[model samples]
Target: MIQKDSAMKLPVLFLGHGSPMNAVRDTPYSRNWRRLGQALRQRYGGEIRAVLAVSAHWCTDGTAVTAMPKPRTIHDFGGFPQELFDVRYPAPGSPELAAEIRSLLGGHAVAADFGWGLDHGTWGVLCHVFPEADIPVVQLSLNVNLDAPAHFALARRLAPLREQGVLIVGSGDIVHNLRLMDRRAPDEAGSAYEWAESARSLVNGWLENGDTQALTDEAAYPPALHLAAPTPEHWWPLLYAAGAAGADEPLQIFNDDIVGKSLSMTSVVFGHDALFEAV
Candidate 1:
């Protein structure tokens, strides 16, 4: 007797979207996200049902799923121009997707207030990727208190959604030390760039080895990461993505560079082409 294989899962991603400015600019990181979206669309096409963004911008004590029919635009950042504030991504919310996520996680999911909208972390990258705002998107708030094990366990709960045509995106900077950034200086000409390069190399080695233990241990990290991430809120999203991958599969780098001194725009994909089969 022969058994049937389940539908192939789509690729999961954690994007190091650098700045709020990238939402409006034509920088390399911005361009890369855009191109990546195009590639993803081509790979999945109509079979791609919806998206759930686990963004750094939304932090809560527990798992919350945004179930609004139409999510509004939220300018979550401050000090940026009114033009930036005015920008909107009118992607519809996926209530079905939300319910599916709840079902997948069983008791771990919680209903979010309806009308929850996209924040900078969601829109900043989506503005480039799904520019037209075509796909229905739902935001999943991070459980900020969860340690490495808990967070990775939560990601495993989301595994079933991958086979259901949901594109899971974890959006945050890999090196997000806001205090160390000098936005006024050019990216290529800075001491922080040198530090960022060193940090990138270190991360690359860990990613190549699929070393989840090392990736999760900040204490053993290089000095650049210590300087880059004073706290792990923005960086932990990468672990969620990594956790969703096969234990031994190598990470694929989509974007890897530093900008604004302290921000490292290093996006990674978790699976191969076969895994990305038409939704």
Candidate 2:
């Protein structure tokens, strides 16, 4: 087996996949995800066993990890084109990894289920990263009700998985205030863009520091964060990824930008050496 630090570590990603359009358009964000996926594969093609995605959409009462051996594509959103609905990511599911995830969380905190499949949050980005849909995947549900601290702790617990070649992904938008999601309001776009950019810069700092405390505490963030995240579900994944960073680990921004008023689709990658060096 490869030594933990010596072998390239699998980096964690925080993808700000804005609109459902990402599932279809070959825009910069989609292209970036694709390029990142290809680069990751080229670096660790045969060694990567599975991908564990923590999507913003599958928020439940408690932490649940999908254990199914063959997970399917779930069209979780509506009002999309038939072509978008038809898009599929056929990444296999890993039972062994599921068991390991359960084991990683210990007995009480983590639960397992067999049927849940990939939601738009997972496939929206993965469709680009692993377009071939060849790698096995496991979807881990977010405890929507859980606070940032809880999510951060959970991420720390999951840190070891990177050594084993599991790419942990956090899927959500940064400035996701649906009330202002106007595709046409120019004023709304400018304000939301400003907020998203500010928030992204602050978040980038925290990630680079691997500051678990700052990530968990709401007050530590800018005032805009409250507006960006009226709920904790979307931002919690970032805490998880950051907590998984240990200390002083380098964080890289894979994609960053604000789209529309309520959608900040800027995404990030943590563990610079782990990912870039290998690439």
Candidate 3:
């Protein structure tokens, strides 16, 4: 076995992917993501081994990872512009890494799932993060049957990959509730509900303070649990990113804003900021 080196450790990211349109549009959110990609190139001297993404859109019966090379770009969402659907990330996949992930999650139930490829949630963030699609990418599915704590536990198994130069990303909205959203005025930060702001604030605090248990406990936060999420898919990815973080690692929040009445644009970063600081 080749020993992992400390210099190769990559950072973990949890992006609040609001709209699929953001993939095609050159918005502030997309620009920020591009900056991170640029920073990665500068830091690792233009070589990021691979990316492992856990997206909200690819929920499965059990945890799984995409293991196919040249995996398909899935247009999972509908009613988007033709250009959005036409766009392709074209990032390669690593079966080796996927198998490694399966081995790591042997404590849990995880398999190599060849059926599902990269979805809107994964590609939308990566399009901006790695526009050239030069590096390999893999998508991990969220287990639909698991609760928040279980999701976090499964994600913790992936923490070792960071040391092997895999960028672990959890893509989902921190505060996502389309049912209560003001559809007419989507992406409105000023009109964000007070309760939504409070909800994200609590989560932000939990991430910053490294309070993983409190963050996962649904009963502790009834309002945010019931209202901010409504459904747990979008909210669950945060736990994945948080679980990958070291116990006392400091967190940095970026693109911090609420959009579309209920969706939050808040993104978080954990570890390996050498290039980020220079940028």
lDDT score, candidate 2, position 12:
80
What is the number of backbone collisions in each predicted candidate, taken in the order shown?
0, 0, 2
Candidate 2 per-residue lDDT, tens place, 151-266, comes to 78778888888988788888887667777566575223235556656776776676666666776787676787777887777777667667777667676675555666666766
Comparing candidate 1 with candidate 3, which one achieves the higher TM-score?
3
Model 2, C-alpha of 20: deviation from truth (Å): 1.7
- Candidate with the larger lDDT of 1 and 3: 3
Better of 2 and 3 by lDDT: 3
Off by over 4 Å in 3: 1-7, 272-279
Give the top-scoring candidate (lDDT): 3
TM-score of each: 0.89, 0.90, 0.94
Off by over 4 Å in 1: 1-6, 186-195, 218-223, 273-279
Task: Compute the lDDT for candidate 3.
Answer: 0.84
In the range 99-132, model 3's lDDT, one tens digit per residue, is 8888888878788888888998999999988988
* Model 2 misplaced stretches (Cα beyond 4 Å): 1-6, 185-193, 273-279
Q: Sort the candidates on TM-score, descending order.
A: 3, 2, 1
